[model samples]
Target: MKKTVTALIGLSLLVSCGNKNQAPLFADVALADEKQTSDWLAYGRTHNERRYSPATDINTNNVADLKVDWFIELPNDVGLVSTPLVVNGVMYFTGTMNIIRAVDATNGSLIWEYDPKVVEEVKGKRKIGWAHSRGISFYEGRIFAATWDGRLIAIDAGTGAEIWSVRTYDMERSLYITGAPKAFKGKVLIGNGGTENGPTRGWVTAYEADTGEEAWKFYIVPGNPADGFENAAMEMAAETWTGDWWKHGGGGNAWHGFTYDAELDMLYIGTGNGSPWNQKIRSPGGGDNLFLSCIVALNPDTGEYVWHYQTTPGDTWDYTSNMDIILADLNIEGEERKAILHAPKNGFFYVIDRKTGKLISAEPYVETTWASHIDMKTGRPVEVEGSRYEDGPADITPSPWGAHNWQAMSYNPQTGLVYIPTHHLSTNFSDEGIDLENWQAREFTGGLGVRRKFSDKQPREYSASLQAWDPVKQEVAWYLPQETFWNAGTLTTAGNLVFQGRSDGKFLAYEASTGEILWEFDAGLGISAPPITYTINGRQYISLLVGFGGGFAGLGADAAELGWSYGIHSRRLISFSLEGSAEMAALPPPYFPEPLNDPNFTINDEMAARGAIVYTSCGVCHGSGLIAGGMAPDLRASALVLNKEAFSSIVRDGILAGRGMPGQPEITERELEDLRHYVRQRAMETSTSDRTGSTNNPRKEVESH
Candidate 1:
């Protein structure tokens, strides 16, 4: 077996050496579809989005012998969540700031690098370039990256020279690319993120692979009817909308998780949540917004819509279908059905007939509070009223984190099961108008109100689980739950093993049939990317991107509730193989800046309550509760907060917006005074505790979720 693999690799290298252009590196979609183990060609390994590997060299029996082969440290502090692609012994993925890196798959050695140079203009207290790019794609002798700065760039695969580039979105708008770029047939496809932060609309565009020319673009939501419809689909979708949705940008961004079916010649796009999240605000008449929270099928030749199945019609909870989608042929009711499997944010696992857009089965995979079930006949969810926060505040389980996020799930053909990274967290939803001043307080969650101040009433501590699901039976085969939430995506191979990383800093593999953990490595940092297996010179290896920060960073207060240390010191690309020994560099401990002592301040409970509300927006940049989760400074220890006059100047006036502190236009003199009182009190308490060697506040300890 070793000799055969070596000879095949040698022959391929000789063929490549005969003619050394980018032609030898081209990844044909059809050829990649049948591939199981030799190489990882596409994002999902195969165009079907199975995320399954056929490598058996590192089986469950010998997986314990696997050691770190090599590691590459990334340069940016932003999270690294890209599922890397390897072809012909070459590895490629995107780091923070959408910087692309090409590495030798066998050893962790950098070959070439390309920085998108995402311009970072500070918007008040926030910098612009912190967003991430999930991964990149190889096609037509070129490498493609959908950058956070809203550009689709193609680079020479062999060399790191820029081939051609095109701006995909308006710089003025918040839309940027974070999902992996995909290439199929003769075109490359990319999507954007940012609808959650602004009145953004979502659209997916396809470009000519050879040239950076726009081939076709598909808008998720209908635009102004006056502008005329882009196609018949828009005309049909417009009828389901009742208000001036176009003004709100009617989101439905195909932000992440797209799959392609070569056999059906169909492109499956999972649309995102609505812009204003609250449907009543965006569309007062309350019609089922077409395309939003839906898995729509489109024709790859043209950007024409074929069929769609909406998961959450009138979506008000950010229940996006933008989670990963897997295609499989399952036997059900005595027949083999071609189906698309989806476990979206809505907390339901759906099996739809991919050809005609019919719902074969839709069942809740988690403890879903908003909907009881989906009616098979109508294919609509039986929503629980008040779940939309129509009458009052309603608590929804599985929160906006969904039962799952963009973390890629894997479907193993051998085990006939899918492994998913799932979370158990809930949020209290309220339908109330946020004060215009505080509108910016929360990252554009459609001006919706959510409170995670669990304080006694919130559910038990949030948790994460690796669930092995039986897709055909629509049931969970086994589950391994953890105390920590926000675990990484899964990768399953023919070796009866499943691999995933944890937010609490561990990379693990579990027995495929049972839930017993087979092996684990203390990564010492969070990972959001899925694991992938590939071979170079007859050696099968595993690799995944690691770093901890992304959407959850901007999710207000308790956003850090899920095990992130807030320390953003390291980003690494880790690879492992049987008995391979490589040492990873040590990680710096979490930042604990010294607190400024304030001997003159008095604690005021009322002032603290008022200040708490004011601090919500600040927590987006600084960690939760002014306790540094490692992104920014621990305000409780800042000298800026120690001085009352300086605090007032920076807080009340736009004095340091360029320095990333947007002044509070919503706070009056009295409110400013109250905020000063609160920060002073917290700072004093922290300083005293540090000096006296007392334990941290229980509330703050729990913030690490």
Candidate 2:
């Protein structure tokens, strides 16, 4: 039987205080201690962001005995991608619309629940973003979380009551928060993602943990000189940029990969790509855009720039350095040096000196065609001629989806290897028809200066693998090919094991050093979140959030074919232990939505053409080319599109906003009709003969990742 509480309850036992004799829960020293393995205090377990545990009770030898200990069903949640933070045996995680839940780590029992009510707060104005949060943070007695509507909130850990809340961005702008709030010292930090949706000048803010007061803010890109530089760092950054780059909101949003070095007393931020993604349009003079796609070290207290190492200088291929920044001590050239292990979207695995932001070694972990290699002396990628689509359309390896996206990679200090969830994909980038000189960014719409070419005739090749890379040797030690792309993040343990969940709903444990699968479990749902391990009562437990719906899963139609259609399977937070005997309920069989046919209704081709432009907003959740990728309901298969009133009530009336569907009050009635017609056209084109439709209808071409 399941044990759950719907209402928030005050539980004194959940706090770290025991008889008023113990140190406070999540103190600065406690969060920084790498030796503590009983609880996961931070996103990366520790400030180092290695995602490795020293606990060894569940070693590779006995990993096969692992079974489900407990699980909590999340029926209302969509994407279960947030990492659960364990504090003194109480697990806290953020779900859809930033709902925070506290559950018993020993047994899956709810302690308290906190809802931020993001939809009601946004008032249906914002339509995009708001899929899932990467995680939450813990400092002292507070749990910190960032909402989809760009608000950072703190809740009392004992009672789940809101302590303080602050908006991180302007409501009018196209900014949203999906990354976890990094808490360190007495402050919590957050950043927003909207580089493609608007003219966003990406930035990160640090706020006082106890109070909602802003402490320090760092803009990833330099703003206009007419407004004056914020500091000398912005002035120094301006020298490397040409043209009115600030007008495009020079995008270097640090959406993920934030690490704080307790030993070095410094902060490392993995910055993002240009606003429009086309440097030719954002930075016409072709100067290396300062801090875009870079590992920038800064003073955590002051938010002051220290040093940076640009991975993709003059980046135009959406190669953001927003991947995980793992801090470790490496013996390079027979000398001990602090290093940052990073595998970004560009397909290159970087090992840089964390102290000075200097490149130690860099190598291609995947098939990299944009750059031949990273220059050892200059630490810059050697770009191949025409790779940037300078002459025309060019097929590039390691597409914008990245060789390694925001998925967390774990580093095992015991094995001297970094376990990375790697993938291989390519995109054909072109600016063929866009007016280069007169291009302008549209509000809340994709501002990518370059267009990704899509064709039904072209065959797309893609694959994923779990790779064990040696930072010291700059090579892959072992690799296991996955069945599909966009696999979940990895977790490594000193127990000589690596745990990762797949999009196919299978969770596996492997020998950390040998790439041998020792155990597997069918989760019955796609998992996009990383698994975390912690111990309570001397029993080590492995836990994972099992649900799929992230960037790639939402956009790629092939991913939707895995049978994890929207709302078909239950989202869950599942845990396992060697002593676990609890059985998991079997999920419904894999479901593939059949396109609904409307014999009575006629599709307006003219309206469909206009609706295609408007579909861009809907495509943020619904798939591109009208194919739903399991994130939202596949409109082609929904009967609601057959009626104009039903479609408008859900799309423009905000009636279903409570169910993760945001209303677009801005969409006019004509646009709504056009959208309905467009979806019907796609349904007719993709419907099969047996489904009361034409057999000759060709499949819609989708954008290659």
Candidate 3:
């Protein structure tokens, strides 16, 4: 097998030798085939989502010497969430604003940039509808990426120009792409992520690599007509769902991560939570919603459903199985078998046999109070009824973000350990008394719910934790606690190091073997993107984009509700390495508004209580009057009323495009006035404590380029 692989690599290198422009040396691991050199050829390395690299030049001992090599500043203040792909001495990545760039890996010089310009129809709505392009895919000299607003584009890897483009879905319906596309076997598979407050079904589609033609699509949730699949599989799927799930678009959105196992000829995809979130709405009858919230294994060539293991049956706690499904071989009951491993949002590390979807073992990787334990015999989660949010203000652990959120978690094959960046924090999640449809528009109504802060409720001993799990033993080996939260993904190196960016703005590297701190750099802002490593010339460089923004970065609905400084004016793409490196380039000035203290308004405790009642009407979408969800701004620290014009326009006209803040006619003028007053008071309270003095605004700070 090794000889065959070596021969293939050699043949590939010979073919590339004729190309004069190609770099003489590519990836750190020189194979017989040079075509595979230097570049991250597939998503998660080779589509199995292993995220493992053969490059060992920067391993354990030398990793400590890793320092700043060369850094390039993007001209725009676009959000940078892309996990860069390095191939043939060039780095390819995307930004939050949906621009793709190809840079010379050796010196951080711009090779080319492709701007998708996912511009909104208007500024306000743009802020609201803006979608992020996390990363892109490469196949046969072309790069593929799904746009924030529903377009699948293929670009020339060398030139960074659009080679062919196809619309993935309709943007008007609120479908967008925030995840990277996976290219395998001459086909491009992509998923749509926008299931926000809007009504949309999640689906995975494959297109012909060369022609840009969609070949086949598998809806994560069953469709209204249900025409595509074989009658047997479709019939089996239909049996699991009750009611007109077609109306609710059958809620399961597989927007996050997926992996393909070539050995098995199967593709494993993580399915998200059902729509309307409230189980009462999705499956009123309550049976295992077969495909929703599960790891589905399918045939890549035919899009045939092979088998599925439901992760969360009738998933009620907003627990979606749509976490990254990594494939690995593990021992179960003394027998080694190929298995699929996952650290789902429900806070459990699940191991299932890949040959046949059967549970091998399951255990909690983080502190979760939601379920008593996973019934290994039945592979079902035994939930404590009181732990669930049935309706009318219930405290649900893990919140909607899950115990381990969507930041990428890396599994190191060398150490046989899975490193996860997790949040030990918990929140009280409630289902506003309203039903599904009404919940969509008037979702934030305050009277519908309340939340008790659990962080302070627990002793200082309890907080966020980063854990390393031994999948073979089905147990946690070690854990490191953070003062706050670690929402970023984990990146493991062969050097026995694990790198992760924290919510508090520290980019840390820990000893992968013992969970001890090796080194940490203050990126000066919270990180939302994953860290990646590659060899440019002879040096191994580590790079990560740091900026404070994203749903986890305290973003609220509408620009006005978010704090400006935290908006990440310098969310620049930064690359670094060791000694005598390229001189650091000067950064552009930071953009911050002068701090201003608004005149205090005397609203007694009684008035605050009265305003709280009024807030019930506005909270329908803003989230229990606190503005918690990323879809909308947090009202507790809102600055809407700080600027009267901005406040009134949103209240009266509504900034539907940007913040998802809708204007309600049912709100009486008196109620609006009271709501405005309540917001002003909240702003004042936030200002006094924030110390930055700048009003919380969620939009990006324009760079003075």
Best by lDDT: 2
The deviation in Å at residue 106 for candidate 1 is 1.4
Q: Write the per-residue lDDT of candidate 2 for residues 290-363, one digit (tens) a residue.
A: 88999888898999999999999888988999999998998888899988899999999998888888888999
User: Which lDDT tens digits does candidate 1 get at residues 1-705?
Assistant: 001111122121211445553435555554346555767777888887888888889988998888888876654345677889887777878775566766667765566677665533222323233456678887766788887667889988766679899998766565557788888878888888776567777899999988889999999999999999999999999999987877778889887878778888899999998877777766778888998999999999898999999999989888999988888999998999999999999888999999999999988888888889889889999998788777877888657767889888999988889898886667766645444223331333234423332233334444567899998888999987676655678889888999988766689988888867888887767667788999877888998877765555444223344334443456677888995778676676543455677676677889888987766546656755565543444677677876778887777664654333445544687778777777777777667553221111112311210
TM-scores, each model vs. reference: 0.85, 0.96, 0.80
Ten residues in a row with the worst lDDT in model 2?
691-700
**Cα shift from native, residue 70, model 2 (Å):** 0.8
After superposing candidate 3 on the true structure, give the runs of residues whose Cα lies further than 4 Å from its correct spot.
1-37, 120-130, 224-231, 332-334, 389-394, 429-432, 435-462, 555-564, 567-569, 583-681, 689-705
Better of 1 and 3 by TM-score: 1
Best by TM-score: 2
Regions of model 2 farther than 4 Å from truth? 1-13, 19-23, 454-462, 689-705
List per-prediction Cα lDDT, in the order shown.
0.73, 0.84, 0.62
**Model 2 residue 209 CA deviation in Å:** 1.0
